[model samples]
Target: MDRQTRSLLAHADHPIAAPLDDDSVGRLLTRAVVRDDARVLDLGCGSAAWLIRALGQRPGVTAAGVDVSAEALERARRAAEEAGVDGRLTLHRGEAAAFEAPHPFEAVLSVGATHAFGGLLPTLDAALRHLAPGGTVLVGDAYWEREPSRWARETLGEYEDLAGTVEKVTAEGWTPVYAHLSTRHELDDYEWNWTGSLSRWALDHPEHPDSAEALRAAARHRDEWLHGYRESFGFVCMALRRTTDT
Candidate 1:
C-alpha cells in the first residue's frame, strides 16, 4: 500500500496514531504545555491530532505542525477549522527533521514519530533544534518490556528496556519531568483498532482497487503484532526538559 493509503487506513479509528488513551493524552499535554500562551510545534505531526488537542485545551496557544503527507496535512487543516483553532494553527508540508520555523516553540512534540528521524535520540535532537530554552519536549517511542525475540527485534527495530531508554535520555542532558507507560489495555486496544479498522474498510469497499492489498496488509500487521512483538513491546511518552546543553 502507498503511504497515504496506509496512513488513512491505520488512523481510521485511532486518530492519535499512538497507543495512548484520551486521558493519557490529556495528562501528557497538560504536563508539557505549562505556558498558557505556549507556542507548540509537532514534528512528523501526521494528522496533527495532538496539536489540535493542545490548541483546544489552551485557547491562548498557537501551534504549528510539520509532516510530509499532503493528505494528512489537509485532514489536519480541516480538523483545525472544525475545532475553531485554524486561526492559531499553521500546517507545513515537509520533512520534520529538516523543517525550519521562523521562531522556536515552548513545546515540541514528536510522539510515536521517532522513526521519522531514525531513532528516539535523533528525534529529540530535531525537537531541540526548534525548542526554546527551558522548553519542554514530549516524545514517545517503543521499548522492550521483556527480552525481544529475533523476529521481534527485526520487525520493530532494536529497542532498549524502559529503564535503559530513560537513562539514555537523561545521559543526553534531559530530565524526565513526567512519564506515561502505555498500559496493557491501551496497547491491545490500539492494535485491535488498527487491524479492525483497516479490515473493515477493505471489507466495506470490496470493489476499490486497493481493497485487497489493504486487507492483506492489515492481516499481516495483526499477525506481526500478535506473534512478533505483542508480549515484549512497550511504549512510553515523556515530558522532558533540557538540564544541560548536549
Candidate 2:
C-alpha cells in the first residue's frame, strides 16, 4: 500500500525484504488454523507465493491459486511443479473480480489484489462467496495517513475509498482478525525486498516483454503513493474469519 510496498511487490523475490515479508507471510499461514485436508484458495496469487509456501511448510493441506493473468498463472504452475507440490497446488487463470469457488475453500486469501478490485467491497464479496462457514480470509492493502488533517480521498487517489470498504466488511459476516497498520520503515523494507526479486526474475524472463515493462513501470505508477504516503503512509492487513453466526 505504501510506495515501498508497491515497489517491493513489484519486485517480489528481491534479495531484500519486500513490503510483505516472507516471515510475516509464513506467520499468517501458521496462524490461519487450517485443519487437516483443508483447502485454501489464493486470489490474485502471483507466482503462487502463498500456495507454494504453504505446501512446503504445512503438509496435508490443498492450495489453489487463481489469477486473471495467464503468464502469472504459468509461472505459478512452474513454481508448483518445481517445488514438487503440483499435486497439492492447483493454479488457475480466472477473473479475480468475480471468481467463483471451484469448491468451498477453508481459507481464502488475496494480497495486494484487494486494492486492485476497487477497494474492499468487491474483494470481500468474492472472498465470502468462496469460503465455507467458519473459513478464513487474509487480506493486505494500503491504509490512511497517520492522523490525517484533510480527508484521505482529497489527498490519496483510489485508496480514498478504503475506509468505507473496511466498514462494509464488518457489516458483513466476516470478523476482522488483524488490521496491521505498518510504519513507513516497515513498508519501505517490504517494497524494496519484494520488487527487487521481481525485477531480477523479470530480467531473466526475456520472453515476457509486458511483465518486464510492468516491473519498470511500477515506480511510475506508484511514485505518488511512495512520496505522498511516506510523510504519513500506512499499511493495513486484515484477516477475516467467517462464521455462520453472522
Candidate 3:
C-alpha cells in the first residue's frame, strides 16, 4: 500500500470522529504503566493522535512522535496545538526505523504500525533499543486470520503475520520486547473500522483498479472473518508488561 498517511487515514473507520483509530488505542494509552515524568516516543506515529491524546489527557508527562512523512508530521504538530498538547508533545519528521530519542524513553508505543516488519527480530530489535529499564509497552497490531479467508487469500495480497513481531519477541525468544500486552483481543477491535474503511475505499477508488480490488477483497474478508473468527463483543485484548532485562 502507499505510504501516504492521508490516503491511509482518509479511508479508515475510526472509533471516534477524530483522527484516532479506535477506542482500543485510548484504552491502551490510559492503562500505560508510567510515572508522571516518564518520557515516551511513538514510532510511526501518524498524525500523532495517540501521543496527543495520551499526553493531552494525562498530566506530568512528555511525549514525542516520529514519522517519515513530512505531511503527517505537520498534521501531528497541528493536532498537538489544537489539542492544547503542544507544550507536552513534539513531532519529528524522520524515519522511525532509524530515529532515536535524545533522552531515554520510559515508554514506546506503536499501534497498527509494526506490520512493516515481516520478521520478529527486526521489530524486537527496534522496540528494545528504545525502551528504558523497567518501562512498560503497549503493543496492539493487526490480526492475521488463522487461515486466510477466500478473498484474503486471493486479492487481499499475502497472508502476513501482523502479530508475529510481538509474539516472536515476548513468547518465542531473543529476550522479549517488553512484556506481552493483550494482542489476541485487540485483533478483533478493528473489524468494524476495517470493513467500513475498505468499503469506502472500494466506492471511492472505482477508477483505481488495484484499490478497487483491494476494497472488494477487504469486504469479502470481513464477512468471512465475522463468520469464522469474530465475537459479539468484537476484539480480543492482551496486556504486556516489560521486564528489566534485555
Give the distance in Å from residue 46's predicted Cα in candidate 3 to where it truly belongs: 0.1
lDDT of 1 by residue, 62-163 (tens): 999999999999999999999999999999999999999999999999999999999999999899998998999999999999999998998789899999
Better of 1 and 2 by lDDT: 1
| Candidate 3 residue-wise lDDT, 82-162, digit = tens | 888898887888777888778767777765555544433454557667888777655544344355555554543343343
Report the lDDT of model 2 for residue 62: 92
Estimate TM-scores for all models: 0.98, 0.76, 0.67
lDDT of 2 by residue, 1-246 (tens): 334333434554532222556667777776663687789988878667778888888679898887766666676788788889899987777777766666888888887777557766678777778888888888876655544435344665445334755776777766777655555666877655544555655567668655657466555435644554555556666778864533
lDDT measured at residue 90 in model 1 versus the true structure, 0 to 100 = 95
Kindly provide the TM-score of model 1 when superposed on the true structure, using C-alpha atoms: 0.98
What stretches of model 1 exceed 4 Å from their correct place?
none
Lowest summed lDDT across 10 adjacent residues in model 1 is found at 1-10
Which candidate, 1 or 2, has the higher TM-score?
1
